[model samples]
Target: MTIASENTTVFDAVTIDRAVRLGTATLHEAAGRIGALPSQIARITPGQSFAGPAVTVSGPPADNLWLHRGLLASSLGDVMVVTVGGHHEAGYWGEVMAVAARSRGVAGVVIDGCVRDSDALANVGVPVFARGLCIRGTDKDPDGVGGVNEPLTLGDVVVYPGDLVVGDADGVVDLPAARVDEILDAADARIAKEARIMAALRRGETTVDLLDLPKETR
Candidate 1:
């Protein structure tokens, strides 16, 4: 059920569901603890959590024209992954955009910038993961430098269109589309191992004994 566009294969629904179930923390660990978005970017709306393929967008600081374009170009179940020069003061997104994203079936939005209309966005029910909330409005300048469906860097991560994006209370993690299957398998194994460790702990085992850590010296 994968869809291809511009030589990129969007992850299928099955893969997205599996990743959502595995969650960002487990997937991040399974991917060798890489692919974490900046800690400043976090789930903004109430109960906000989502997993989907990225629809990458980049725009000039304090401008949102390209974000609109990205939303329009996105398909059902795509997450709008946006980078706006790491600007944090302007409200590049809000309630209106959340409604539009919902109409387009965009699963969520992860922006390395601020957003506004916090209450309305929460009611709109489109998951929004953003850097912060700002009331300063952004300009829809037509001449602003921007791009949609292109690779964009957020923090130290280079997010590509069609890459798997999983976000939750713990924060967002980007997984390479090609490595999703392997990562998921590794996550399952990690979960099983953790379960065993938890069981051992319940049986009165100590972390130093179970994990073979060095003993504390007086």
Candidate 2:
């Protein structure tokens, strides 16, 4: 029977932590040039990075009814992913929400729209990434509803519930939990290849020579 539940499934803590420790950029490379969120989604507060499974949500331009539900529905280590139907002018998330999320052990929040309370958010103790900040508040529209654990897109990547989400100063990225091991393996190879290139440079080889750039291009 079909049923509704607030609980969102997630990957193991160790797997997610390892991906977070690997950083978003490496995962992008590992995932074969995919999984990086748009550059427009940026860190509002500095010095914190996070990795966790997504709990997707969305709503209209300035209604945050879904976000309120997301907080109630989220579990420890679940990162809230909000897409506001291309609305980038509402402060749908802020200090109050950040505080609530932090208390729930929510890893972080990524919003396609705007947010506010930058200073207050800085002290809220959870990382937040958004398109920009706005002081305008959202409406508690009774007509508004948002889905959780659904697929989400951020211009640069698509994310699903339980997908590994890694974010930092570089940006955010998503990887299907089932593909984590394979992607990490590729990342390891890429790192090794870069290491070899660095070693060659230490031997006084020019980058152009090591990379074999076209003579005319150099």
Candidate 3:
């Protein structure tokens, strides 16, 4: 496979599943293997241990009509990632949307804005990561654009419609579709090396010895 570059764009689910199944630690580790870009919402429900394709939505600051539409259009085993033009105040997701997403077989949601209904979301057990929580509601006056299977900007990172999104308590990561195989191999090597280092530690090895650090010149 060709090396994935900054401009390469694709969202192959098969490659993503291979990476996830190789035991890449967590979503955060898999992200690190690709590139550290997606941010965590500080506090949110833990994500399910499943990998799937991403469906992206982008629109005006306070409108979420497109989000609702996107939810209805999404297929099974998809994660709805929304970019609300960086407007961090109004709540873009809540109990109703979560329920709808779950019914559509969506794996979870990652939004660059606020969300509401923490208790309900916890009870439903559908993962949601956002900038924060707020009671401020959004407007139904539909505005802005919605793109299915399109490239979008999320925070400082660029995400394509089908890019692999691996998110957990640590945060969310966007892996380029093309380089999934290479990154998975790298993560496997990393885990094996860490295991050996851990075994040495259990045998009473010091940090300096385990890490091969030079002795102090004192």
Candidate 4:
């Protein structure tokens, strides 16, 4: 069910806008507080964030050729979600790829591996979320076991092509594209509820009182 009909639009402008506004945290809450990728995968550019349909890529350890293919296969507003078979030290992405991605209108990237060229990546205007940075380069093995636009499991979250991928400073979360409307509705309600709670806190209500937790016993 991850792959949908070719006629189905990968993502809509309105949905991307709303999802980016709500952010990964709110959408995760709306998704029953699940589908969060590993916390180690975080934003490389401090203020940058993105929300777009995923173009999942699975690459072999220490190899990045599939990522290039994934980038080529993607259209505007696609987020490349890649996993590199537990190889965390290779610099699988860098400034050059960031420049190319920005030029092609890729919304962002989330990889379960490392990236390098911090200075240029921070300036290239593409939001990248990865495990960490590394100086070691990667290979482009033609015989490597990898595929573009395939399902990938990063940590406990399963990412499939066309799923909505949202990433912010907190982390990344995958929301099912088919449930975008439902998730948005629930996120709206949660925001309203949290707003009321914030108002209550400003009025001097304690967390225990607001949440109705049992009183502490000596």
Clashes of 1: 0
Lowest-sum lDDT 10-residue window in model 2: 1-10
Residue pairs with backbone overlap in model 2: none
Put down candidate 2 lDDT per residue, 1-218, tens digits, no spaces. Answer: 11126545666777777777777898898898888889999999888888887888877778998888778778899888889878888899988889999999999898988999999988888999999889998998867666666676889677887777888999999888778889877877878898999999999999998899876844
lDDT of 4: 0.88
Q: What is the lDDT of residue 9 in candidate 4?
A: 40
Model 2 residue runs over 4 Å out of place are 1-8
TM-score of each prediction: 0.94, 0.91, 0.81, 0.94
RMSD of each: 3.3, 2.5, 5.5, 2.5
Can you give the lDDT of residue 87 in candidate 4? 93
lDDT agreement with native, every candidate: 0.88, 0.83, 0.68, 0.88
Off by over 4 Å in 4: 1-8
Candidate 4 lDDT over residue span 34-148, tens digit each: 7899999999977999998888888889999988987887778989999999999999999989998998899999999999998899999999999999999999988888877
Local error of candidate 4 at 216, Å? 2.8
Candidate 3 lDDT tens digits, 1-218: 11112222344677556655553244346446444445545336644444556777775688787788768657677777787777788889999988888888787788888898888887776688788898888876544555445667775678776677666555677767666666667767777888899998999988898888988976
Task: Sort all candidates by TM-score, best to worst.
Answer: 1, 4, 2, 3
